[model samples]
Target: MGLLVGLVLTVIGFFLSVLAFVLWIWMLIDCLKNEPSVGNDKIIWALVIIFLNGIGALIYYLVRRPERIKQTGQ
Candidate 1:
Protein backbone atom coordinates (compact mmCIF):
# COMPACT_ATOMS: atom_id res chain seq x y z
CA MET A 1 0.00 0.00 0.00
CA GLY A 2 2.73 2.42 0.94
CA LEU A 3 4.62 1.64 -2.26
CA LEU A 4 1.51 2.28 -4.35
CA VAL A 5 0.88 5.56 -2.60
CA GLY A 6 4.48 6.63 -3.21
CA LEU A 7 4.20 5.76 -6.87
CA VAL A 8 0.98 7.72 -7.17
CA LEU A 9 2.56 10.77 -5.57
CA THR A 10 5.55 10.53 -7.88
CA VAL A 11 3.30 10.39 -10.90
CA ILE A 12 1.37 13.39 -9.71
CA GLY A 13 4.58 15.31 -9.19
CA PHE A 14 5.73 14.46 -12.70
CA PHE A 15 2.45 15.63 -14.20
CA LEU A 16 2.58 18.89 -12.29
CA SER A 17 6.11 19.57 -13.56
CA VAL A 18 4.99 18.86 -17.11
CA LEU A 19 2.03 21.19 -16.69
CA ALA A 20 4.29 23.98 -15.54
CA PHE A 21 6.58 23.50 -18.52
CA VAL A 22 3.62 23.57 -20.91
CA LEU A 23 2.32 26.74 -19.34
CA TRP A 24 5.73 28.37 -19.70
CA ILE A 25 5.93 27.39 -23.33
CA TRP A 26 2.45 28.70 -23.98
CA MET A 27 3.29 32.01 -22.40
CA LEU A 28 6.48 32.28 -24.45
CA ILE A 29 4.66 31.53 -27.69
CA ASP A 30 1.85 33.95 -26.92
CA CYS A 31 4.30 36.68 -26.08
CA LEU A 32 6.33 36.05 -29.22
CA LYS A 33 3.23 36.22 -31.40
CA ASN A 34 2.22 39.61 -30.14
CA GLU A 35 3.12 42.45 -32.54
CA PRO A 36 4.61 44.42 -29.73
CA SER A 37 7.57 45.75 -31.74
CA VAL A 38 11.19 44.60 -31.92
CA GLY A 39 13.49 45.53 -29.04
CA ASN A 40 10.43 46.05 -26.89
CA ASP A 41 10.92 45.32 -23.24
CA LYS A 42 8.05 42.87 -23.14
CA ILE A 43 9.70 40.73 -25.78
CA ILE A 44 12.83 40.63 -23.67
CA TRP A 45 10.77 39.67 -20.68
CA ALA A 46 9.08 36.97 -22.70
CA LEU A 47 12.40 35.55 -23.80
CA VAL A 48 13.56 35.64 -20.24
CA ILE A 49 10.44 33.75 -19.26
CA ILE A 50 11.04 31.27 -22.04
CA PHE A 51 14.66 30.59 -21.22
CA LEU A 52 14.87 31.30 -17.51
CA ASN A 53 11.63 29.62 -16.47
CA GLY A 54 9.69 30.41 -13.29
CA ILE A 55 11.33 33.52 -11.93
CA GLY A 56 11.42 35.09 -15.37
CA ALA A 57 7.73 34.44 -15.89
CA LEU A 58 7.00 36.04 -12.56
CA ILE A 59 9.12 39.06 -13.51
CA TYR A 60 7.47 39.27 -16.91
CA TYR A 61 4.05 39.44 -15.36
CA LEU A 62 4.78 41.62 -12.35
CA VAL A 63 7.38 43.98 -13.81
CA ARG A 64 7.51 44.01 -17.61
CA ARG A 65 4.05 43.36 -19.06
CA PRO A 66 2.33 46.08 -17.07
CA GLU A 67 4.59 48.84 -18.34
CA ARG A 68 4.47 48.50 -22.08
CA ILE A 69 7.66 49.49 -23.86
CA LYS A 70 7.58 51.67 -26.94
CA GLN A 71 9.91 51.30 -29.88
CA THR A 72 12.72 53.80 -29.95
CA GLY A 73 11.82 56.23 -32.72
CA GLN A 74 14.78 55.08 -34.83
Candidate 2:
Protein backbone atom coordinates (compact mmCIF):
# COMPACT_ATOMS: atom_id res chain seq x y z
CA MET A 1 0.00 0.00 0.00
CA GLY A 2 0.92 3.68 0.03
CA LEU A 3 2.20 3.54 3.60
CA LEU A 4 4.48 0.61 2.87
CA VAL A 5 5.93 2.35 -0.15
CA GLY A 6 6.57 5.46 1.91
CA LEU A 7 8.37 3.47 4.54
CA VAL A 8 10.57 1.81 1.99
CA LEU A 9 11.48 5.14 0.46
CA THR A 10 12.25 6.57 3.86
CA VAL A 11 14.59 3.72 4.70
CA ILE A 12 16.44 4.10 1.44
CA GLY A 13 16.76 7.83 1.95
CA PHE A 14 18.10 7.32 5.45
CA PHE A 15 20.76 4.92 4.23
CA LEU A 16 21.78 7.34 1.50
CA SER A 17 22.16 10.15 3.99
CA VAL A 18 24.31 8.00 6.25
CA LEU A 19 26.48 6.97 3.34
CA ALA A 20 27.02 10.58 2.41
CA PHE A 21 27.99 11.46 5.94
CA VAL A 22 30.47 8.58 6.09
CA LEU A 23 32.00 9.64 2.80
CA TRP A 24 32.38 13.18 4.01
CA ILE A 25 34.08 12.12 7.19
CA TRP A 26 36.35 9.69 5.41
CA MET A 27 37.43 12.31 2.90
CA LEU A 28 38.05 14.86 5.58
CA ILE A 29 40.27 12.45 7.49
CA ASP A 30 42.14 11.38 4.39
CA CYS A 31 42.81 14.95 3.41
CA LEU A 32 44.12 15.83 6.82
CA LYS A 33 46.34 12.84 7.27
CA ASN A 34 47.60 12.07 3.78
CA GLU A 35 47.41 15.33 1.87
CA PRO A 36 50.62 17.28 1.58
CA SER A 37 50.97 19.99 4.17
CA VAL A 38 53.60 21.81 2.14
CA GLY A 39 51.50 24.90 1.61
CA ASN A 40 47.78 25.26 2.27
CA ASP A 41 46.57 22.18 0.48
CA LYS A 42 45.41 20.36 3.57
CA ILE A 43 43.76 23.39 5.05
CA ILE A 44 42.09 24.31 1.81
CA TRP A 45 40.64 20.87 1.26
CA ALA A 46 39.44 20.76 4.84
CA LEU A 47 37.62 24.02 4.41
CA VAL A 48 36.06 22.88 1.16
CA ILE A 49 34.78 19.71 2.77
CA ILE A 50 33.48 21.55 5.81
CA PHE A 51 31.78 24.37 3.96
CA LEU A 52 30.48 22.47 0.94
CA ASN A 53 29.62 19.26 2.79
CA GLY A 54 28.96 16.11 0.77
CA ILE A 55 29.48 17.67 -2.63
CA GLY A 56 32.92 18.91 -1.68
CA ALA A 57 33.86 15.51 -0.30
CA LEU A 58 32.77 13.83 -3.52
CA ILE A 59 34.73 16.34 -5.51
CA TYR A 60 37.87 15.67 -3.50
CA TYR A 61 37.42 11.93 -3.82
CA LEU A 62 36.75 11.94 -7.57
CA VAL A 63 39.08 14.72 -8.63
CA ARG A 64 41.95 15.61 -6.35
CA ARG A 65 42.50 12.34 -4.51
CA PRO A 66 43.64 10.28 -7.46
CA GLU A 67 45.91 13.04 -8.65
CA ARG A 68 47.47 13.45 -5.25
CA ILE A 69 47.98 9.77 -4.78
CA LYS A 70 49.49 9.40 -8.22
CA GLN A 71 51.68 12.46 -7.99
CA THR A 72 53.04 11.85 -4.52
CA GLY A 73 52.79 8.07 -4.37
CA GLN A 74 50.94 8.55 -1.13
Candidate 3:
Protein backbone atom coordinates (compact mmCIF):
# COMPACT_ATOMS: atom_id res chain seq x y z
CA MET A 1 0.00 0.00 0.00
CA GLY A 2 2.79 2.40 0.90
CA LEU A 3 4.65 1.56 -2.30
CA LEU A 4 1.54 2.19 -4.34
CA VAL A 5 0.98 5.55 -2.65
CA GLY A 6 4.58 6.52 -3.24
CA LEU A 7 4.36 5.61 -6.89
CA VAL A 8 1.19 7.67 -7.30
CA LEU A 9 2.76 10.63 -5.58
CA THR A 10 5.85 10.34 -7.72
CA VAL A 11 3.77 10.37 -10.88
CA ILE A 12 1.86 13.40 -9.67
CA GLY A 13 5.10 15.18 -8.86
CA PHE A 14 6.53 14.38 -12.27
CA PHE A 15 3.44 15.71 -14.01
CA LEU A 16 3.55 18.94 -12.01
CA SER A 17 7.18 19.45 -12.91
CA VAL A 18 6.37 18.83 -16.56
CA LEU A 19 3.54 21.33 -16.36
CA ALA A 20 5.87 24.00 -15.01
CA PHE A 21 8.46 23.28 -17.67
CA VAL A 22 5.87 23.54 -20.44
CA LEU A 23 4.65 26.86 -19.09
CA TRP A 24 8.16 28.30 -19.07
CA ILE A 25 8.81 27.09 -22.59
CA TRP A 26 5.55 28.59 -23.78
CA MET A 27 6.47 31.91 -22.19
CA LEU A 28 9.85 31.83 -23.91
CA ILE A 29 8.16 31.17 -27.24
CA ASP A 30 5.76 34.03 -26.67
CA CYS A 31 8.65 36.31 -25.85
CA LEU A 32 10.33 35.40 -29.13
CA LYS A 33 7.28 36.16 -31.28
CA ASN A 34 7.39 39.50 -33.04
CA GLU A 35 4.93 42.00 -31.71
CA PRO A 36 2.26 43.29 -34.04
CA SER A 37 2.85 46.88 -35.09
CA VAL A 38 -0.66 47.78 -34.00
CA GLY A 39 -0.48 46.41 -30.47
CA ASN A 40 1.81 45.97 -27.50
CA ASP A 41 -0.61 43.68 -25.67
CA LYS A 42 0.90 40.41 -26.83
CA ILE A 43 4.35 41.53 -25.86
CA ILE A 44 3.04 42.63 -22.52
CA TRP A 45 1.41 39.24 -22.08
CA ALA A 46 4.66 37.52 -22.94
CA LEU A 47 6.44 39.41 -20.22
CA VAL A 48 3.67 38.69 -17.76
CA ILE A 49 3.84 34.98 -18.59
CA ILE A 50 7.60 35.02 -18.19
CA PHE A 51 7.27 36.62 -14.78
CA LEU A 52 4.18 34.83 -13.49
CA ASN A 53 4.60 31.40 -15.11
CA GLY A 54 1.52 29.16 -15.38
CA ILE A 55 -1.17 31.54 -14.24
CA GLY A 56 0.08 34.27 -16.51
CA ALA A 57 0.32 31.95 -19.46
CA LEU A 58 -3.22 30.80 -18.83
CA ILE A 59 -4.56 34.32 -18.67
CA TYR A 60 -2.53 35.55 -21.62
CA TYR A 61 -3.50 32.65 -23.84
CA LEU A 62 -7.12 32.46 -22.75
CA VAL A 63 -8.06 36.04 -22.05
CA ARG A 64 -5.87 38.64 -23.68
CA ARG A 65 -3.65 37.50 -26.53
CA PRO A 66 -6.11 35.71 -28.79
CA GLU A 67 -8.21 38.77 -29.41
CA ARG A 68 -5.15 40.91 -29.92
CA ILE A 69 -3.61 38.52 -32.42
CA LYS A 70 -6.91 38.10 -34.21
CA GLN A 71 -7.24 41.81 -34.55
CA THR A 72 -3.72 42.03 -35.91
CA GLY A 73 -4.24 39.07 -38.30
CA GLN A 74 -0.86 37.67 -37.36
Candidate 4:
Protein backbone atom coordinates (compact mmCIF):
# COMPACT_ATOMS: atom_id res chain seq x y z
CA MET A 1 0.00 0.00 0.00
CA GLY A 2 2.79 2.41 0.90
CA LEU A 3 4.68 1.65 -2.29
CA LEU A 4 1.61 2.13 -4.43
CA VAL A 5 0.80 5.44 -2.84
CA GLY A 6 4.37 6.64 -3.36
CA LEU A 7 4.25 5.62 -7.00
CA VAL A 8 1.01 7.41 -7.53
CA LEU A 9 2.37 10.58 -5.99
CA THR A 10 5.49 10.41 -8.09
CA VAL A 11 3.47 10.05 -11.27
CA ILE A 12 1.28 12.96 -10.32
CA GLY A 13 4.33 15.07 -9.61
CA PHE A 14 5.83 14.21 -12.97
CA PHE A 15 2.70 15.15 -14.86
CA LEU A 16 2.39 18.40 -12.93
CA SER A 17 5.99 19.28 -13.72
CA VAL A 18 5.41 18.64 -17.41
CA LEU A 19 2.28 20.76 -17.35
CA ALA A 20 4.17 23.63 -15.73
CA PHE A 21 6.92 23.40 -18.32
CA VAL A 22 4.38 23.49 -21.13
CA LEU A 23 2.68 26.48 -19.59
CA TRP A 24 6.03 28.27 -19.31
CA ILE A 25 6.87 27.60 -22.94
CA TRP A 26 3.45 28.64 -24.13
CA MET A 27 3.66 31.90 -22.18
CA LEU A 28 7.14 32.62 -23.50
CA ILE A 29 6.01 32.16 -27.07
CA ASP A 30 2.88 34.22 -26.48
CA CYS A 31 4.96 37.06 -25.08
CA LEU A 32 7.38 36.96 -27.98
CA LYS A 33 4.68 37.03 -30.62
CA ASN A 34 1.90 39.08 -29.10
CA GLU A 35 3.66 41.55 -26.82
CA PRO A 36 4.36 44.88 -28.40
CA SER A 37 7.99 45.66 -29.15
CA VAL A 38 7.58 49.38 -29.09
CA GLY A 39 9.62 49.78 -25.94
CA ASN A 40 10.95 46.99 -23.72
CA ASP A 41 7.67 45.26 -22.92
CA LYS A 42 8.41 42.28 -25.12
CA ILE A 43 11.95 41.87 -23.90
CA ILE A 44 10.96 42.34 -20.28
CA TRP A 45 8.05 39.92 -20.36
CA ALA A 46 10.12 37.36 -22.19
CA LEU A 47 12.84 37.67 -19.59
CA VAL A 48 10.28 37.39 -16.78
CA ILE A 49 8.85 34.23 -18.28
CA ILE A 50 12.29 32.74 -18.85
CA PHE A 51 13.76 33.60 -15.50
CA LEU A 52 10.74 33.04 -13.25
CA ASN A 53 9.32 30.06 -15.12
CA GLY A 54 5.91 28.81 -13.92
CA ILE A 55 5.23 31.62 -11.49
CA GLY A 56 6.01 34.30 -14.04
CA ALA A 57 3.89 32.60 -16.65
CA LEU A 58 0.98 32.45 -14.24
CA ILE A 59 1.45 36.10 -13.40
CA TYR A 60 1.39 37.06 -17.04
CA TYR A 61 -1.65 34.91 -17.69
CA LEU A 62 -3.58 36.44 -14.82
CA VAL A 63 -2.50 40.01 -15.36
CA ARG A 64 -0.96 41.25 -18.59
CA ARG A 65 -2.41 38.80 -21.09
CA PRO A 66 -6.02 39.74 -20.53
CA GLU A 67 -5.24 43.42 -20.55
CA ARG A 68 -3.24 43.05 -23.73
CA ILE A 69 -5.94 41.07 -25.47
CA LYS A 70 -8.53 43.62 -24.45
CA GLN A 71 -6.44 46.53 -25.64
CA THR A 72 -5.40 44.98 -28.94
CA GLY A 73 -8.86 43.61 -29.62
CA GLN A 74 -7.35 40.24 -30.41
Candidate 5:
Protein backbone atom coordinates (compact mmCIF):
# COMPACT_ATOMS: atom_id res chain seq x y z
CA MET A 1 0.00 0.00 0.00
CA GLY A 2 2.82 2.41 0.86
CA LEU A 3 4.52 1.74 -2.44
CA LEU A 4 1.40 2.45 -4.37
CA VAL A 5 0.91 5.76 -2.54
CA GLY A 6 4.50 6.78 -3.24
CA LEU A 7 4.15 6.04 -6.92
CA VAL A 8 1.01 8.06 -7.15
CA LEU A 9 2.63 11.02 -5.44
CA THR A 10 5.61 10.86 -7.75
CA VAL A 11 3.43 10.91 -10.81
CA ILE A 12 1.50 13.87 -9.48
CA GLY A 13 4.71 15.74 -8.79
CA PHE A 14 5.99 15.10 -12.29
CA PHE A 15 2.84 16.46 -13.87
CA LEU A 16 2.91 19.57 -11.71
CA SER A 17 6.51 20.21 -12.65
CA VAL A 18 5.68 19.93 -16.32
CA LEU A 19 2.76 22.29 -15.96
CA ALA A 20 4.94 24.88 -14.27
CA PHE A 21 7.55 24.59 -16.98
CA VAL A 22 5.00 25.04 -19.73
CA LEU A 23 3.52 28.07 -17.97
CA TRP A 24 6.96 29.61 -17.62
CA ILE A 25 7.74 29.17 -21.29
CA TRP A 26 4.37 30.45 -22.40
CA MET A 27 4.70 33.57 -20.26
CA LEU A 28 8.23 34.20 -21.45
CA ILE A 29 7.12 34.09 -25.07
CA ASP A 30 4.09 36.21 -24.39
CA CYS A 31 6.20 38.81 -22.66
CA LEU A 32 8.60 38.96 -25.58
CA LYS A 33 5.80 39.26 -28.10
CA ASN A 34 4.06 42.06 -26.26
CA GLU A 35 4.27 45.45 -27.90
CA PRO A 36 6.26 48.19 -26.17
CA SER A 37 3.10 50.13 -25.56
CA VAL A 38 1.53 47.27 -23.64
CA GLY A 39 3.51 47.78 -20.47
CA ASN A 40 6.51 49.34 -18.83
CA ASP A 41 9.24 47.32 -20.56
CA LYS A 42 9.22 43.97 -22.32
CA ILE A 43 12.77 43.12 -21.34
CA ILE A 44 12.05 43.66 -17.68
CA TRP A 45 8.99 41.42 -17.71
CA ALA A 46 10.92 38.70 -19.52
CA LEU A 47 13.67 38.84 -16.96
CA VAL A 48 11.17 38.72 -14.10
CA ILE A 49 9.51 35.63 -15.54
CA ILE A 50 12.88 33.99 -16.11
CA PHE A 51 14.18 34.61 -12.64
CA LEU A 52 11.06 34.28 -10.49
CA ASN A 53 9.69 31.26 -12.35
CA GLY A 54 6.04 30.32 -11.91
CA ILE A 55 5.21 33.08 -9.47
CA GLY A 56 6.49 35.71 -11.85
CA ALA A 57 4.42 34.28 -14.65
CA LEU A 58 1.32 34.47 -12.49
CA ILE A 59 2.05 38.06 -11.62
CA TYR A 60 2.50 39.03 -15.25
CA TYR A 61 -0.70 37.34 -16.29
CA LEU A 62 -2.64 39.05 -13.54
CA VAL A 63 -1.12 42.51 -13.80
CA ARG A 64 0.49 43.15 -17.14
CA ARG A 65 -1.50 41.36 -19.78
CA PRO A 66 -3.42 43.69 -22.06
CA GLU A 67 -7.17 43.73 -22.23
CA ARG A 68 -8.68 41.99 -25.25
CA ILE A 69 -10.35 44.17 -27.84
CA LYS A 70 -12.92 42.93 -30.30
CA GLN A 71 -12.52 44.34 -33.78
CA THR A 72 -15.32 44.59 -36.26
CA GLY A 73 -14.39 45.66 -39.76
CA GLN A 74 -15.06 49.36 -39.85
Candidate 6:
Protein backbone atom coordinates (compact mmCIF):
# COMPACT_ATOMS: atom_id res chain seq x y z
CA MET A 1 0.00 0.00 0.00
CA GLY A 2 2.77 2.40 0.94
CA LEU A 3 4.63 1.72 -2.28
CA LEU A 4 1.59 2.44 -4.39
CA VAL A 5 0.93 5.66 -2.51
CA GLY A 6 4.52 6.76 -3.03
CA LEU A 7 4.31 6.09 -6.74
CA VAL A 8 1.12 8.04 -7.05
CA LEU A 9 2.57 11.01 -5.19
CA THR A 10 5.64 10.98 -7.39
CA VAL A 11 3.55 11.01 -10.53
CA ILE A 12 1.46 13.90 -9.22
CA GLY A 13 4.58 15.87 -8.37
CA PHE A 14 6.01 15.29 -11.83
CA PHE A 15 2.82 16.40 -13.50
CA LEU A 16 2.68 19.59 -11.43
CA SER A 17 6.26 20.39 -12.31
CA VAL A 18 5.57 20.00 -16.01
CA LEU A 19 2.51 22.21 -15.75
CA ALA A 20 4.51 24.89 -14.01
CA PHE A 21 7.19 24.76 -16.67
CA VAL A 22 4.67 25.15 -19.47
CA LEU A 23 3.03 28.07 -17.71
CA TRP A 24 6.42 29.69 -17.24
CA ILE A 25 7.30 29.37 -20.89
CA TRP A 26 3.94 30.62 -22.11
CA MET A 27 4.06 33.66 -19.82
CA LEU A 28 7.62 34.44 -20.85
CA ILE A 29 6.72 34.41 -24.53
CA ASP A 30 3.59 36.46 -23.97
CA CYS A 31 5.49 39.01 -21.92
CA LEU A 32 8.14 39.33 -24.60
CA LYS A 33 5.60 39.92 -27.31
CA ASN A 34 3.31 42.42 -25.59
CA GLU A 35 4.35 45.98 -24.75
CA PRO A 36 3.49 47.06 -21.21
CA SER A 37 1.19 50.05 -21.11
CA VAL A 38 1.70 51.23 -17.52
CA GLY A 39 4.41 49.30 -15.69
CA ASN A 40 8.13 48.61 -16.29
CA ASP A 41 9.83 47.96 -19.60
CA LYS A 42 9.81 44.72 -21.59
CA ILE A 43 13.28 43.71 -20.48
CA ILE A 44 12.34 44.07 -16.83
CA TRP A 45 9.22 41.95 -17.19
CA ALA A 46 11.16 39.34 -19.08
CA LEU A 47 13.79 39.24 -16.37
CA VAL A 48 11.11 38.95 -13.69
CA ILE A 49 9.57 35.99 -15.48
CA ILE A 50 12.98 34.36 -15.84
CA PHE A 51 14.11 34.89 -12.27
CA LEU A 52 10.93 34.59 -10.20
CA ASN A 53 9.68 31.51 -12.04
CA GLY A 54 5.97 30.66 -11.86
CA ILE A 55 5.16 33.39 -9.37
CA GLY A 56 6.45 36.03 -11.74
CA ALA A 57 4.28 34.72 -14.51
CA LEU A 58 1.23 34.80 -12.26
CA ILE A 59 2.02 38.34 -11.27
CA TYR A 60 2.38 39.43 -14.88
CA TYR A 61 -0.92 37.88 -15.82
CA LEU A 62 -2.78 39.44 -12.91
CA VAL A 63 -1.12 42.84 -12.72
CA ARG A 64 0.20 43.74 -16.15
CA ARG A 65 -1.82 42.20 -18.93
CA PRO A 66 -3.92 44.56 -20.98
CA GLU A 67 -7.64 44.44 -21.58
CA ARG A 68 -8.93 43.15 -24.90
CA ILE A 69 -11.29 45.09 -27.13
CA LYS A 70 -13.79 44.00 -29.75
CA GLN A 71 -13.80 45.69 -33.12
CA THR A 72 -17.01 46.34 -35.02
CA GLY A 73 -17.40 47.08 -38.69
CA GLN A 74 -20.18 49.13 -40.27
Best by lDDT: 2
Q: Which candidate model has the greater lDDT, 2 or 5?
A: 2
**Candidate with more favorable, higher TM-score: 3 or 5:** 5
lDDT of 5 by residue, 1-74 (tens): 99999999999999999999898898888777753544567778888999999999888777777432112111
Worst 10 residues of 5 by lDDT: 65-74
Q: 4-72 in candidate 4: lDDT tens per residue? A: 999999999999999999999999999999998889998999989889999999999899999999989
What digit string (tens of lDDT, one per residue) describes model 1 on residues 1-74? 99999999999999988887776776676566653666675567666997789666666656555554343221
Lowest-lDDT window of 10 residues in candidate 3? Answer: 34-43
The candidate scoring highest on TM-score is: 2
Model 4: colliding residue pairs: none
What is the descending lDDT order?
Answer: 2, 4, 5, 6, 3, 1
lDDT of 2 at 16: 99
Tell me the tens digit of each residue's lDDT in model 3 across 1-74: 99999999999999998997797777557645744535775567677887888877777668656675676664
Separate clash counts for every candidate = 0, 0, 0, 0, 0, 0
TM-scores, one per candidate: 0.64, 0.97, 0.69, 0.96, 0.79, 0.78
lDDT string for model 2 (1-74, tens) is: 99999999999999999999999999999999999989998999999999999999999999999999999998
- Candidate 6 worst ten-residue window by lDDT: 65-74
Q: What global local distance difference test value does model 6 have?
A: 0.77
TM-score of candidate 4 versus the correct structure, residues matched by position: 0.96
**Whose TM-score is higher: candidate 2's or candidate 4's?**
2
lDDT of 3: 0.72
Task: Summarize candidate 6's per-residue lDDT along 1-74 as a digit string, tens digits.
Answer: 99999999999999999998998998898877755544667788889989999999888777766431111110
lDDT of 1: 0.67
Model 1 CA lDDT for position 34: 53
- For residue 31, give model 3's deviation from the true position in Å: 4.7
The local distance difference test score of each candidate is 0.67, 0.96, 0.72, 0.93, 0.77, 0.77
Distance from true position, residue 29, model 5, in Å?
Answer: 0.2
